[model samples]
Target: MKRPIILLMGTMIFGILLSVLISVLFYGKNEVSNSIDAGTKKIVQKEDKDPYEKVDKTSPTISVYNSSTNKIEEMDIETFLYGVLSAEMSSDFSEEALKAQAVAARTYIIYKKENNMTKGHKGADICTDSNHCQAYFSYNELKKNKGEDWIKESYPKIKKAVDDTKGHILTYDEKAILPLYFSTSSGKTENCEEVFSSQYPYLKSVSSPYEEQSPRYYTETKISKYKFVNALNKSYSNISLSVDNLINQINVLERTNAGSVKTIQIGDKKLSGRNIRTLFGLNSSNFDIGFENDTVVFKVKGYGHGVGMSQWGAEGMAQKNYKYYDILCHYYTGIEIKDIY
Candidate 1:
């Protein structure tokens, strides 16, 4: 009877141990499976994610008035900027300068479009005429003008400039600004009110010391005393400008903070410097007059309106290792570089 009782207790103990071992094996398998499943899920989640999910990759379309062809053409913003960058700045400029130009051009277009400033273009958002709006040259036109070798070397650079900047634009107070830019400045940018009728906070006067290397920075235009007197007389009916007394007749009345001529006393009339620049086809309004016998030598500094970002100045900043955004911000005061889809 004692042997049977011991055998029964041993059988029960062995059964209990077997049940515990089976339960432990099943639990261990489940944990390993769960670990593998979690890792797989993590891999799948990472694979499904987009690297540029937050980035704005949209390139909008716009209408540009082709002044050469006298027609309105539709193009994507990037393609349009390719033409603008090619026509606006030298292809030999540094990559950062080119990128800065791309953003400025983009901002100008958006500002015009948002403000409904298309009446000048006959219902177009902008025009290819450099006189009225930004200049744009198509690929074929560029190939014709710049030669195939230049196209091969420079087209890619221009396209990269546009692509790298994508949809960047200059803004103030969360709104797009005019983003006016020019070939060079007279050691400083002009105040908006001095050049245009309106004043802009971002268009205030700022130092631009890098434009000295520009070919148009200091230029001399020699006009015959007879031509000078006749030109002023044609505009001012009440003035008398004798060739011998031309120096006395023409005097710079006032200069802006940027060293550009603000007002000039020509004969009996007080004219804005911009008026004289237009009349004489001068390179810029920052000019000093000197007499060389019968010639009226107009020594001018800089080019364009001298209102905003100087292209040569931008290049100068690029040479100093400044990034594109830095160049833009330096020229356009109190402005933010924003991305528009």
Candidate 2:
């Protein structure tokens, strides 16, 4: 009887141990699997020599790559990230919450290219808003979620990623955007399956935000020749640079009203959107049609989506001597900042 009891007990112990081992193995696999999705998993599970881990041998070049008197000047990843942070933290963000906006922006930009896209460099092309590919706009209006630590850590992780990409971001000359990816309120970036996905929490009352909504006006002013080159690379005749042609371009943009319509009405002539942007300098998302009083009555606030990486906020932090990592930490949360370069 004693021998039989001992054998049964031993069997039970072995079974329990086997179960625990299986559970541990599964837990680790899940941890890694949870990091990315089916597609992203493939990207993460590649050989070290994977050029995608560093820089791709293939990358698209700028349109004006050949027709250039000056070599395309590359910007530092730090500078780009700094710009993103500074813009996102603008104080004019009265319509939306600032912190969440910054996080979403960082999330979008940082996670857009995982494993190694962007040659390990992260950034987006020149856009008034950070909505080219990475991270769409967001508004955390449903309920104020609590994840301060998570929120705080986003910035640093992003900074570390940018640091890793510094060598690449500083060298790639074309419109080297930080191939970041993002999602609308869809729980995923692929499709906006629901109405309240938070991508456009700004449009609370409206569904399918295809409606045209923005103020429009015109103005006339002369801008420096170099200014036009930096702002928009309109094919300028290597032969001649006419300021009037610049004005005409603005008129065309305003008439189309595709992205923006900033025109200057000088006497009887109307300037173009590009021209007015160049002249009046439409730096932020919204522009001033005209000043109302002591206050600039222009529709504006929180640079970018009001969703991520506030440039003004960053500048404010930088003024306080906040290290880049510290600044990133303040915005993002729950992510380890690994220098994979």
**Local error of candidate 2 at 313, Å?**
12
Estimated TM-score for each candidate: 0.82, 0.27
Assess the local accuracy of residue 238 in candidate 1 as a C-alpha lDDT between 0 and 100. Answer: 82
lDDT of 2 by residue, 1-341 (tens): 99999999999999999999999876644413211222211112211121223533432221111111222234432444433533444333221223223333433443433323332122322222333332111112111331455336443443443343333321112222222221111111111112113432111111111112111122223344455434333433232333343433322323221122334343234554344443445432223343222222323221222222333443334443333443333332222232222
Which model scores highest in lDDT?
1
Worst 10 residues of 1 by lDDT: 38-47
Q: Give candidate 1 misplaced runs (Cα > 4 Å).
A: 1-54
lDDT of each: 0.84, 0.32
- lDDT value for model 1: 0.84
- Model 1: per-residue Cα lDDT over 1-341, one tens digit each: 99999999999999999999998876644412211121102101111111222257778889988999999989998999999999999999999899999989999999999999997798989999998998889999999999999999989999999888888888999999999888988778888898899999898777776788899989999999899889888888787667776777888989998888889988778998889899999999999889899998989999988888899988987776666876777778788877777
